[model samples]
Target: MSGREPIVPLVRRFSPTLSPSDDESTDSEAVHPYLFGKNSSGWEVIEEKRRCVIIADAGAGKTHEMLARARYSAERGRYAFFIRIENIREAFASAFDVGDAESFEKWIGSEDDAWFFLDSVDEALLQDPLAFEEAMRAFAARIADARERAYIIISSRSYAWRARTDRQLLDQLLPYESPKANEIGEEEIEEAVQTGMSDPNKLTNSIDVVILDDLDEDDIRMFAAHLGASDIEEMMQEIKKAGLSSLSSRPYDLLGILTKWRSDRQLGGRLGYLKHSIAVQLDGINWTACSIDPSILPEAVGRIAASVILTGKAEIRVPGSANDERGFDPIEVLPDWPRENVVALLDCTLFTDAVYGVVRFRHRDIRELLAAEWFADQLANPERRAEIEAMLIREKYGERILTPRFRPMLPWLVLLDDRIRREVTAIRPEIAVEGGDVASLPVEERRSLFHSIVEQIAEGKDDRGARDNDAIARIAHADLSSDVAALVERHAENDDALFFLGRLVWQGQMTDCLPLLLDIARSRSRGLYARIAATRAVFTTGSKEQRDTLWDSLLEVPNKHA
Candidate 1:
C-alpha cells in the first residue's frame, strides 16, 4: 500500500438563516464540527441522518469528496453504494458482476447503512435536465420510502440553489411577481406567466443540507505542500491577493491556478481561472493530448454546450448513435465551429469519453461557463448578434435561454446589454433582481420595482416566499442607490414580509436600516419575530447607549425569537 496522508476537506451544515418560516427546534441538532480528522467521524455524519445533500460551487470537489468519504466508509466495513445519477439506468446493472436479481434482493434484505451517494443533482440522470428531474424525483422517492435503513446524499452547485453567491445570474425561476388579476394586456399576462415558474429549493427541502466549505489558507498550504512547491510562502502571498482568494479555495481551480502561476502569467477572474485549467491540458501535458491552438477551445466547447443545454438534453452526444434515439451528434451543434479542433479535445483531459464514444467536457462547470461566455461574447460581433440573441430569447415561456440550463448566460447577457435588463425589469421586477448591481439602475425604476416586489411577497404564498426574500435581499444591497426607505413604509405591512426584512437587516447590521429597525423594535403592532429580529439587529451593531436603550425598552416584550 502506498502510505500517504489523506487530506480531508472541511464541511458544514446548511443553516436556515435565510428561511424566516423555519421552526425554532434545531437546537438539539448535531453541531457538525467545522474540522474533520483522520477518524471516520466525517464519514459517519452522512449516516447520522437518512438523507443529506452536500452542495458546493463548480470544481469545488463535491464528487471527489463524496467518493473519498464513500471509499473510507467501505474500507471501514460499512455498506455503501455510489451511484452517478446520470447512469441510474445501468447503475445496479454495473454494480454487480456475479449477482443476479435474486442475489441483489437477498443482499438488500440484510443490508443496513447501505448508503447511496447521488453525485450531482443537477446532472442526476441524463444530459437533459427535464429527464434529470424525473430521475431525481424517483430517487428522492426511493430514499424517502426505502424499507432498508439506508442513507442518501446528493450534491449541487450553489447558484443552482440560491443567488447569494458572487457567480449568480438572472434567474428564470418564476419570480415572486405573479401577475395580478387586473393586468390589462394579454402579452403582459403571458410575460408574467413566463417569469413565474419553478422553485427547485423544494427538491432538497426535506433533506438535511451541508455546504462543503471552501478550503482555508492552511488547507491551500497543505495542498501546495503536496504539490511539492518549494517556495510556498511566495505562492501563499499571491494566493492571498484579493483576486485569487476564491480561486485558491477550490481544489480543482487551485491546482490549475498554482500550475499556471508558476509560469508567471497574470490571472484575473473566473474566465481567466477556468480558461487556464483547460489551457494546461491543451498544452500537451497528458495522455491523448494535443498542442492544438488553445484560443478556440473555450468557444468550441461553449458552442457545443449551448446547443446541448438549450435542446433540454444533458447536452452530451453519443457518437454512432443513429439507431439510438436518445441523443445527437456533437458536430451538429454549431455548423461553423471548427470540427477537427473540437474532436481533438474530445479525448483529452479537458474532455471525457462518456460510456461508448459519447463525449463531454471532463469538467461540467467549464462547459457551462464557456457556453455562456461564448454566447455573450458573440454579441460583440455585429454579424452574429441577432442570431445569438434571437436563439436565446424565445416566445415560449421558460424555454430557450430562460431555462435553468441557460441560467449561467443570464448575468453575462444582462451585463453585456443594459437595455435588455431595463426592459425585462420593467416587464417584471423580480426577474432582474438577480441581473446584477442594483445601485447602477435609476432610482425611480428601482422604487417602482421595490413596491412591486413587496406586493409580490404577500402573505400565505408558498411557491414564491423565498424568491421574494431573495429579491428583497438583492435590492437591500443597493443601499447606495435604491430607495429602501419605501420598504420601511406599509409595504405589505405583513408580519412575514417584515420578518424577511428584519432578517436581511440583521444579517450584518446594515447601518442604514438601523433607524427603521429601532422603530420596529419598539412598535407594539409588529409580530414577536419581527420585533425581536429588529431588536437583535440593533444590538448587533448599535452603540452601547443604543443597545442598552433597546434592551431596556424590550423588557416588556417576549424573548421568544431573540
Candidate 2:
C-alpha cells in the first residue's frame, strides 16, 4: 500500500544448526555458498538444491525474496506455487482433500516440475505450532513420495525458530529423508553425518539452510542510489552519526530513514526519523473535509498506539456506531475529534494499520516509541502526569505492573519528561534518570537521593545490575557530579558494576565524570579488573593527566590479579 519499491536483499546459505539452548556445540559460524546470484535471481543459486529454508530477522526481505524467486522461476517456464504460510492449512486442505497423493498432485498441477515457496513460516508457528508442524509434515511427505518433481522453500524469522523447540518439526518438513533401503547404502549415511547432517540416516544433504545478512555499506549505497538521493554519501554519514547504523542494516528501517531524509534532509535518531516520517505523510493529506483539528491528530493516533501496546493487543477494534460493543472506542479517547478523522490520521502513517476501522501500530517498536511520545506529552499536564505515574508503578493487569515489552521504552520516556524521570527514580532509586532537573533540587535533598541510590547499590538491593548500569550512564548524561562520585565510591568494590559504569562513561563521552573514574582507578580497595576498566574510561575521556595517573596506579596494583 505504501508507494515504496521493495529492495532485494542478499542471503548466504549454511547448514542448519540446532538452537544454542539445544546444542551448545552447534557451529555459530555461518557456513556458505552464497544464495544470491550475480543477476539477483535465487533460481540460479538453488537450481541444484531440492529444498531450502531461509531464516532472517523481521523485515529483512524474506517475503520479497520469495516473490522474486517465484517470478524468476515463472519466467523460465516453470510453475511456482507461492503459499503464504499463514494460509498454508487452508491451501493444503483444499488441494489435499482430493484424498491421495496422486489426486493432490493433479489438483495443484504438481506433476510437472515446480517450485513451492512457503512464506512466513514464523507466522504459522506463532498462530499454531502443532498445526504448522502437521501441515509441514504432510507437505514434506508429498514431496518425498513424488518422483522428485518439485522443490520446496520455506522462510521464517530466525528468532521464532530458535525460541521454539521445533527443530525436529523442521527436520520432518525438510525433503531430506533417505530413499528406500534397497536404493541407499550404509556408506552414504556415514558421509552425511561427516558433512554435518542433523540425522545421518536421513538425506540431510538435500536441504540447504540460509540466513539473510543485514545490509552492508554497499547495500546502503545501492539503496540510496535507488532512492535517487543526490547527497547519498552525506546522508550515510549522518545516519551513522545519529547512531542509526543498526536501523540502516534492516531494509524496512532503511526505507523509513530514506523517506524521512527526502522530506526533511536532516535525519535525527531512529525515533526522530519515525516521527518525521509520520509528519511527512500527514502533511500530504487534504484535511479540508476532516472535523478534527490538524494539531490534535497526532495526539489521537498516539493514544491509539499507546492503548494497543499497553494492552498487549496487536489491534484494537473501534465500534462503528454507538450501539456497537466491539471494544474500547477510539472516539472515547478523544471526545472532541470524530472517530473517522482519528482513523484517517492513523491510516496515513506508515507506522499504523487501520483496516475496517481496527487500528494498531504496524511494528512493536513504532508502537513503543509513539507510546513514549504520548506519555511525554501527557506529562506536560500535572494531573495527567500523576495518572501515568500511578499506572506505571502499579499492576493494571494480572501480575504485570508494566508489560515487559514496554521496558525498553522507559529510557526514552524519561528522556522526554523531567517529571517522569524523577518519579521513576523515586520508585526505582537504583534506576538512572537522564536530563532531570537534579541541579535545581535542594542540596540536602540531592545528597539524600544520591546517598540512597549508593546504599541500594552497596547492598545489592536491586539484582538487575543492568538497570543500575543504565542509571549510572543516565546520571553521567545529566552530569550530576555528586551523584557520579557517590556511585563510584559505593560501587568501587563491585567489579561488574564498576566496569559497566566505566564503559557507559566512555561510550557517552562523559568527560565531567572522568575525574571520579580516575579516583576509582587509583583506589586500592578496587580490584585489578575494575581499576583497569576505570583507567580505560579515563583514557577514552581525553584527559592526559588522568591517563598518566591511571598508568601509575595500574603498575602499583598487584601483578598476580592483573
Per-residue CA lDDT of candidate 1, range 432-495, in tens?
5543334345666656666665566544322232242223444554342224444655642576
Give the runs in model 1 whose Cα sits over 4 Å from its true position.
Answer: 1-43, 55-61, 89-106, 124-133, 136-146, 156-291, 315-344, 347-365, 377-390, 396-405, 418-509, 518-562
Q: In terms of lDDT, which candidate is strongest? A: 2
The Cα error of candidate 1 at residue 263, in Å, is 7.3
Where does the lowest 10-residue lDDT sum fall in candidate 2?
29-38
| Global CA lDDT computed for model 2 | 0.57
Residue 299 CA displacement from its true place in model 1, Å: 2.0
Counted clashes in each candidate structure: 8, 1
Please give the distance, in angstroms, between residue 290's alpha carbon in candidate 1 and its true position after superposition: 4.2
Worst lDDT window (10 residues) for model 1?
Answer: 166-175
Per-residue lDDT tens digits of candidate 2, residues 78-181? 76666655444444443211133344456355557667777666456534536557667656665565626667777766434433334445554563445664
